[model samples]
Target chain A: MQKQVEIIKANGEREFFDEGKLRASLLRAGAEDSQVEAVLRHISKELEDGMTTDHIYRHAFSVLKDVQNPRAIRRYSLRRALIDLGPTGFPFERFLAKLFASQGFEVKNDQILQGRCVPHEVDLVAYNENKLVMVESKFHNRMGEKSDVKVALYVKARFDDLSEQLFDYGKARPLDEGWLVTNTKFTENAIKFGVCAGLKMVGWNYPEKGSMRDLIEDSRLHPVTCLPSLTKEERELLLNNDMVLCSQILDSQSKLIELGIKREKVTTIAAEAEALCGR
Target chain B: MQKQVEIIKANGEREFFDEGKLRASLLRAGAEDSQVEAVLRHISKELEDGMTTDHIYRHAFSVLKDVQNPRAIRRYSLRRALIDLGPTGFPFERFLAKLFASQGFEVKNDQILQGRCVPHEVDLVAYNENKLVMVESKFHNRMGEKSDVKVALYVKARFDDLSEQLFDYGKARPLDEGWLVTNTKFTENAIKFGVCAGLKMVGWNYPEKGSMRDLIEDSRLHPVTCLPSLTKEERELLLNNDMVLCSQILDSQSKLIELGIKREKVTTIAAEAEALCGR
Candidate 1:
């Protein structure tokens, strides 16, 4: 019998190697079926007696970078890329507002407004021609961390306070809805509480088919943080300049050059952005 | 040499029992100096090796209840008594508003207003001749629990949201300040954060002599739950009828009788309320 393989986790717990989880992650990143299978089989043979998941991840990542499709590898690291986009959540907030902008919403982030009790800092506020939404983002840098029910309650409670004033003395129409967005997942209880409280949750893989991943995938409004070709300093330069999306990079190619992206790389980035936006 | 006595803490840690800590607590509850020393001595004798903190609490509580001054005993149990004031926090909200009312503020509790992002439920909103303030209450059932920095941050963030609307589109006048009120105490970090953020904090013994206890004692606007004369059913009855403060019972004597407080008890309750409310 083949030896049972053990993989170490971030918290130092050891568990059996989970190929299904890896396969699902690859699929989410836009990996083709054949490539994914070949990569997995290659890693299966390379497994050490007690290798860490980090090592396994690096092995897979190298395979991805070396493989012909850089786009699929970019998509695979999207969650990590989202985390790397932030030391604080300010950059992520800008990225999300820009994503909404791509979807034809006039969006604002980090807006302050009066609630009945106290004032609140809204992470993102979006208004279409018809509806306005208040969004709160619960960001975590860790992979398995979740936004729990307390956060859901907190958001809904604040929303309830603010909505009362909105109806009584609001400038425009009362807000149509409130939203809670997270870079990671929502706890089951959070989802349950959010639904009961009438707050929408946009999280990775949450609500299955219409998750944040699906929304971004459909819109093709990928954040600048997700671009594989851009150097770290170059990405930060664009983010600092308030150009959050790959589309923003294309629109402001000269700005990217000013931020020290070489012209050839800028051309490649534009091609990638165009390819991403096309589908 | 007298053996050093160890007392268990709420979190199940044990430390040397210090009479100064006990004396400070007794003094805070308005216990006379002699009575405080005697009570501490008695508890010191009764304590055995490895006695649990809950056991120590019950012993001390019994001593407080039996000693001469019922009012002082009421002050000692103020935190616990406040917890019993709620089926939810609705009655406590009313009670807090009435306390503010005694301070010459026209106060409203549980009001909903539109914030910039969503509607929020304000616990208490007070308007005096000079200023308007928004208040948030943090109530804890446990004796040692505190309103920590996260709660402070939460309150300040919410206040920032509300104040934005006050600047942009407020009617009459914008709020003058925000205050966080709690039945127990604020953590040191909470106090530090509040001070830096310019949000006022009130709790049992925070802010030195000007604590929540000081405010309550000064105003004599005690919650009906603080009255030992009333049965639990009667307290709940008064709470449900929106008669949260002791003064409310005196103002509505007929309502107390309607809730089945006998005519004699009604007279006693009225006298106590009057005595409590006196300048």
Candidate 2:
């Protein structure tokens, strides 16, 4: 058992907690950055004295929930809380993706494409020897009347984007199947709509529920880390490095554009190189 | 001391003491809601056993950055992370308002004027026995060449909106003052412009760091809380009660309108009652 830590609040009260697990969970969720350290320092400075682990978690999560990219950290923090309490439909799609990946499917998370106008970022795309599957995940407590329509739209959007056949990877092919993964059971109308649209629907059913843990164990995914644990100097270094890399990439791209090299050709060469390098 | 916890990765090895704190810090700032919880759960379920916390925080915050809201939760989350480690300009206005309130000044945070065309939401409006102050806070890593022009524009916007006639509170007369706070040291031109515009400028001069905190503490302004913290049942109860009250008020007003009642007379009565009730 991990020893509990106490946080002192502004009013001279002490809040005790077994925060090691929470901290570990945050680190696993990918929060390593200077900003995280700064936030923790602020918490320490603002301490009046007595604050509970739950209070800290709630406050921290609340603050972070408003951040630009909160999905991973929020999920990690919530999982820690749920594991200690009771589960909710928090990590519904992520859980399903892990389960599917464990069963020997190659999972590509957050695949981005340059859409006709804005960038189209898909949640998860899985490919195997037999087929390519595009999935849209939903973690709602309840699906309303329009939920199925929304899912159908998402499936259609993915299919349309994939059908463009832009990427030259072993003769670009159309999407083999579309899947909708929802935490709650779909409405009858949704199931019918999904079937009509030629999309597969997977609700979190009982048999799948029993095998969830095993599936998670089998699928080899990475853990996310929190950002607060870094020192000031370390954060500056990382930020500087990122800025440098971004600048370099931009500089290279600009040079290529200046040389009158067509963007499509450049992209093709880059993609081929990346594929050969196994990136 | 809190005991360190380790996460077991896919390779059956433990990754120890990963220090990703940015996400945790942002969470500490504010990200507490059911939607955030749902998103986090999705990310966690998709995780591989060995992933680092940095990856998770980056991915999560990135997703949240795209959400649309007047309060700019993404910016606030980033500001919190920055403040937790130390102080930044982004949250300077709110921080200062809190400090002023702690010092016995009556402070109003995010005062929204619905009558206005664009619904001007002032960052902080503060009053004391001798002073009525309007403050604008700016967060910048560096003082740009156009810094002075930006400040001038902000001051002009506020001045234009304010009613010229001094607010009369019976025997109490209003005293006017305007202030601008910034993270970086202001440019010489900016300082000159502020002086010309009749605005006092305060820059975070390192030794005076405590001054800002003091101002916030003195202001005693409370942090804003979102609506979702309460359970669905609680929210529904409050909402239903509010709807009933609004309906009653509307019905009474409509009846008065139908009975040859002048709009001015009805307004006067309501205003009088509100004043008497201190609402």
Summing lDDT over every window of 10 consecutive residues in candidate 2 chain B, give the lowest-scoring window: B270-279
- Candidate 1 per-residue lDDT over residues B1-279, each given as its tens digit: 233777666456787765665555445445677776677777887877676554554455456545647666657656556878864767767778878887888887777755554455678888866887889987777668899765876676567656766631134777678899888888786777677768989888888977878887777777777655566787788888888777677678888778777765565455445444433
lDDT at position A58, candidate 2: 42
Candidate 2 lDDT, tens digit per residue, A116-157? 322445677777777777777665543331244435444554
In candidate 2, stretches whose alpha carbon ends up further than 4 angstroms from where it belongs are: A1-94, A115-118, A141-148, A166-171, A206-279, B1-256, B259-279
Kindly report which residue stretches of model 1 are placed more than 4 angstroms away from their true locations once superposed. Answer: A1-75, A167-171, A275-279, B1-279
TM-score of chain B of each: 0.69, 0.39
After aligning candidate 1 to the native by TM-score, how far in Å is the CA of B167 from where it should be? Answer: 43
* Model 1 per-residue lDDT at B56: 57
Give model 1's clash tally: 31
Candidate 2 global lDDT: 0.43
Interface RMSD, every prediction, one decimal place? 8.0, 20.5
